[model samples]
Target: MASPGAAAAPRRGHSPLLLAAALLLALAPSPTTAAGRGVARECTYTLRVKTSCASPAARTSDAVAVAFGDAYRNEAHAARLPTTSGSRALERCGTDTFRLSGP
Candidate 1:
């Protein structure tokens, strides 16, 4: 009992929920593979730390220490980042590069 000129709603094979689920699955990160089992791999990280020079005491005499790792307990530690060479600081703002390897 509808008008003849009225348009019919379109049907799609992919529903909104199905499309959303597919998109999420596509964007998900892939799990790590075991291809290199027992083999050691190294990871290098370059960290750059900057301090605000606006303050009169922008520089610090204390040493800077860094520690980082993954959730699985794999970690790297540095007792102190080399900020100075002899009496003079290498640079107020500089980059520290380091590498860590593990099996």
Candidate 2:
């Protein structure tokens, strides 16, 4: 029988296993890992005629193009200017700025 007030023996190799698990967890991918996936980014478009447009948060560059087209069309309509085609607007309105950030 164990003596009263005697300390229990340390478990064999338990600490190492715990430490390895901790390391694995630390090295594992996080819930917010980007992993080359696209994130919401802001992009500005500038047209040849000095018309400027800003897009809403977009996940990919292609999405930015679509957003730009929509914004440009609305702005042009409001300004009583002719709306350009999506491809034409994209070609004319070169990207002024594009910034990437994590989710």
lDDT of 2 by residue, 1-103 (tens): 7899998875563212111001011122345545456543232232322222322222112222211233323221112223334434222223322221111
Model 1: residues >4 Å from true position, as ranges?
1-35, 86-103
lDDT of 2: 0.28
Q: Model 2 clash pairs?
A: none
List TM-scores for all candidates, in order: 0.45, 0.16
State the lDDT at 70 in candidate 2.
39
Point to the candidate with the largest lDDT: 1
Check candidate 1 and list the clashing pairs: none
The best candidate by TM-score is 1
Candidate 2 residue-pair clash tally: 0
For model 2 the local lDDT of residue 44 reads 29
Error of 2 at 39 (Å): 0.5
